[model samples]
Target: MYWFLLLMAGVFESAFAIGLKLSDGFSKPVPSLLTAIAIALSMLMMSLAMRGIPVATAYAVWVGIGVAGSLTLSYLFLKEPINSMQLISVALILFGVLGLKVTSTG
Candidate 1:
């Protein structure tokens, strides 16, 4: 259940990030509302996950997932640059997140 919640939180983190960009600096009302909702839901899910997950671990994973997802979305949808260096960096972040979970027995 905790892992499930954390994954959901990560997805919402991605959603909110895309929403933020779509909001166009919050000048668009619909996207702004979506951004608010996505951020709220992400936080809620993270809080729920925290009941069973350590703070540092969960946070690192959450941010890692967010950074990867958001950057990928930007590349695909927004036509942003996705150079090899950036891709490698995001992959490293994912590996680090997994490493944190795998290395810790606590």
Candidate 2:
């Protein structure tokens, strides 16, 4: 359950990023409101996840998910280009997150 919350937090973080982009420096009211809500929800979910997960592991995993999710979403919807090197870097980050999950006590 905590892991699921962590995943949701990461997804929200991705949405926050996308929302921020769409918000245009908060000039667009609806997107700005969504960005604020996404960040709040992300933090809330991450805090919930920390109840059962080690802070270090949870944080790293959250960031990993956020980075990957944001990149994928940007590529698909925002037409952002991704390169091979960036993919390899993201892969390494994911492996590190996996290792942390495997080794963490909480």
Candidate 3:
């Protein structure tokens, strides 16, 4: 359950990042508000996940998910083209996340 919450927190992190980008520097009200909501939810989920997981592991995983998710989501939503270098970087981050999960207990 805590692991799931950590993943959810990461997803929320991605949502807020996209929302921030879409907000055009907060000039847009809707996206700005959505960004705020996402940020709150992300922090909440992270806090909940920390109850069962070590802080370092949970924080790293959350950030990993956010980075990988945001990269893909940005390409999809913003029509940004992802180059080979970025793809490799994301792949590495994913691998690192997997490594952390495999090594971590509780």
Candidate 4:
């Protein structure tokens, strides 16, 4: 359950990061509002996750999700470069996250 919450927090962190770009420096009201909301939700979820998951492990997982999700979003929506290196890095993050999940479950 806490891991799930951690994942959701990561997703929200990604959302708000993308939302920040979409908001164009908060010039656009709707996207900016979404960015704010998403950020708040991410923090809330991460705090909840910390209750069960070790702080170090949870932070690593959270960062993994944010990095992977944000990169994908940037590639697909923002026309950012998506090269082999980028994909490989994302995969590495996934592996690390999975390792944390598996090993920490005990």
Candidate of highest TM-score: 3
Q: Which regions in candidate 3 have their CA more than 4 angstroms from the true location?
A: none
Q: In angstroms, what RMSD does candidate 3 have relative to the true structure?
A: 0.7
Tens-digit lDDT string for candidate 1 (1-106): 8777887899899989999889999999999999999999999999998888899988998899899999988888989988899999999999998898787543
Tell me the tens digit of each residue's lDDT in model 2 across 72-95.
Answer: 999998999999999999999899
After TM-score superposition, what is the CA distance of residue 84 in candidate 1 from its true location, in Å?
0.5
lDDT of each: 0.90, 0.94, 0.94, 0.94
Clashes of each: 0, 0, 0, 0
User: What TM-score, to 2 decimals, does candidate 1 have?
Assistant: 0.93
Over 1-106, each residue of candidate 4 has an lDDT whose tens digit, in order, gives 8988999999999999899999999999999999999999999999999999999999999999999999989888999888898899899999999999999952
lDDT per residue (tens digit) for residues 1-106 in model 3: 9999999999999999999999999999999999999999999999999999899999999999999999999999999889999999989988998998889887
Determine the backbone clash count of candidate 2: 0
Clashing pairs in 4: none
lDDT of 3 at 90: 88
- Stretches of candidate 2 above 4 Å error? none
